[model samples]
Target: MPSAPGTGKGGGPDHGYPPVGRLLPVGGGVVHALTTGSGPDVVLLHGASGNLRDFTFDLVGRLARDFRVTAFDRPGLGHSDPLHADGESPAEQAAVLDAAAGMLGLGRAVIVGHSFGGSVAMAWALEHPERVAAVVTLAGATMPWPGDLGPWYRIASTTFGAATVVPLVSGWLPDSYARNSVASIFAPQQPPDGYLEHVGIPLTLRRAAVLRSNVRQVAGLKPHVAAMARRYPGLSIPVEIVHGTADTIVPAAVHAHPMSRLLPNARLTKLPGIGHMPHHVAPDATLAAIRSAAVRAGLN
Candidate 1:
């Protein structure tokens, strides 16, 4: 099954900026995505267990003002179909993204990737340097998978492999399961209402293929980060990393800290009292970091 277009309503048109919606077919599946506003291109990638909409709504709208904001549902998430085979690794996903960019007439784009999306964007930039104008990673995981996993996580991963069974067993999962899961990623502060309902449930239900591919990608992170780190010194483009000091999902010490140290020209921003999903918890700060990176890239 190829990726498909998004079926839900996107943001309404504002100030004559046409509402953006599209489903571009690439390879076996179609990639559901949207493009809004106009100028230099900026591609937004969502993290694990999330779709493009995971970005704070206001942030997306704000970014669309300066750059042609492009966001998409990865394979098997939202309206996009999952990978048809086991070959849909991070590198392969990057290839699809490159093809999508070409199809969209974006020759070069500033890639703003969140969490796992950051990994994808980095891999894409590494593979096709010419197509990337700059790179920004938000709470990205750029390290090896953790050796220790609680029993629940192990079980969840195993069950996610058999996600076809999720609908059948969703009843057994507590109502607060998804909400609590996302809440744990942040500090003690509660996230916006409907956060999990809007972002989490649909993802778990719609993104089985991507979830499976992520298992493999997570396992391969160490080598990938190491290889990419070696290439960073060769990169002249601007790279910015934003992470939360209190992030529990992808620890700052293990992921962002090492990444910031390795990349020769990288700038790192650590948000106080923030957590994994900084884009949601601190949209203003995230947007500021993005604007700063864009300025550094001479796109602003």
Candidate 2:
């Protein structure tokens, strides 16, 4: 049974931003999670270089009104302890998060993934179908891209960079640079006022966030995704993919368009002239996609 919505951590130290959610000490390590509202279970996994705050900032609060919202900091991203010091593949992330959800009594929820999180959500749906009621992917990088992720990720993914370079960069990184980066993600559509501050984008520059993000991004992810893509046809659960046509980071034409045809029960929602961060740039459309997935999954 879902309990009434409650807060695990609210704000105190860093002005008004609290990263750690509910810390669950399972077996050995601790898993940080944020849970609220009470209804059909919904688990949110954030993108790369982010934490649960990404959702808690806006979408979770709104979705909580209709669903029990649980957003987790992927290992080493926010307050969650790292399962591996190097990095975790989407499949590995899915395993850890799925087990954590099981411990929380989240028994089969509509899994929503934004950007990098969308990849993990797909992995969960593919590997553990019983625990996933449905799937909603927002600008997910599911299909394999042709080339490398560019200079930054290439250099940062190395062990030497993760240990040395990342910390150095994170320490000297400017907030303005971070803000500009956020703005780029919202290209073709401006980000909502205070969205960057609300999500605590600067936190992504932290040592752990930087290292884990880079390591995961440039760690030859194409092979893994290609393998995952092969298994999509076998996945029978409801899937809703929400993408912006103008997303330069992960183009809908490349990822979402091809994915829609691949999945037997998948629908694509392509927003014209929108950029990468559709959840923030186009929240209503994203919410509608989630609702549609829920209905298709028989959760509504």
Candidate 3:
């Protein structure tokens, strides 16, 4: 893979590509995320077990034409330091995002969240409706956490939780392990090789607290979903939801379909034959959804 022009060892700007991965102090510790493009501010949040680099390089560059995109590594995922304070729930994560946006001088902007990030975006919009210009959720976990996530998810969650006991031990999580685990959530086909490596695999593995926080974030979804879904009726801002009909990770029946039904002003776009990671597999369609959502939100 060609290295982004000026991006250095740490994924910073190296070849005039603008910094693709960097850290910014949000509240207490630094928040790890990537910023590129220039236009209406659009915050992109990745899913569970993912960092900022999850957004495809081409997608970020294309979106930059109309929107300044900021894809953040939720607490503990990438270069950002783990959250040490209480209230690391989805709602709290949204608050952290709000603060980060302010610090970056971003006014009301659109939010595009994928998988777990979608949940955070919804919670953020519910809490601070005025700050959000619009929202686009891609295969987001809008419904309550399913009771059955198969044995693997349970084991992984438990393992991740236990790993948090010792920082040193947790830091030893292998890049292969992280990559394989993430790959399992998608279709049989794998993403491009070295994708995780380029996105800071070692940094994420070292952040045990962030992993633990993510496990808790996943577990606490039921109540958050219930409450947030109810608040959708009050949302005046435009909303868009895109989900692959064949998604296996979050399941379309629970999230995309239900969320569309609840949100009076929301539009749902179904992608046939695609899986959970549409942005990686179908960047153009994902970009279209984002642009459509932005237009609906009056960001044109």
Best by TM-score: 2
The C-alpha stretches of model 1 lying farther than 4 A from their native spots are: 1-20, 145-172, 206-223
Residue 203, model 3: lDDT of: 45
Model 2: how far residue 213 lies from native, Å: 4.6
lDDT of 1 by residue, 1-300 (tens): 332223322111121221135777777567777888887788898876666667535567888888888887665454555554332455667888888888888867888888878888888888888788788899986655557545533444454544644334443556666666767766656778766644535444333444444444444455666666677667677888999888887888887888777777789999887888787778888888788777888777
Per-model C-alpha RMSD: 5.4, 4.3, 5.6
Query: Could you tell which candidate, 1 or 3, scores higher by lDDT?
Result: 3
Lowest-scoring 10 consecutive residues by lDDT in candidate 3?
7-16
* Model 1 residue 6 lDDT score: 38
| TM-score, per-candidate, Cα-based | 0.83, 0.91, 0.83
Q: In candidate 1, residue 69 scores what lDDT? A: 84
User: Per-residue alpha-carbon lDDT of model 2 for 51-123, expressed as tens digits?
Assistant: 7887877898889899898999776566555666556788878888888898889977999998888888999
The whole-model C-alpha lDDT of candidate 2 against the native structure comes to 0.78
Residue pairs in steric clash, candidate 3?
5-14, 5-15, 6-13, 6-14, 6-15, 7-13, 7-14, 7-15
lDDT of 3 by residue, 70-182 (tens): 88867645555455433257787888778777777787788988998999899889998778988989889877755755553354456543454535545566667777866
Q: Tell me how many clashing residue pairs each candidate has.
A: 7, 0, 8
Clashes of 1: 7
Q: Model 2: which ten-residue window has the lowest total lDDT? A: 3-12
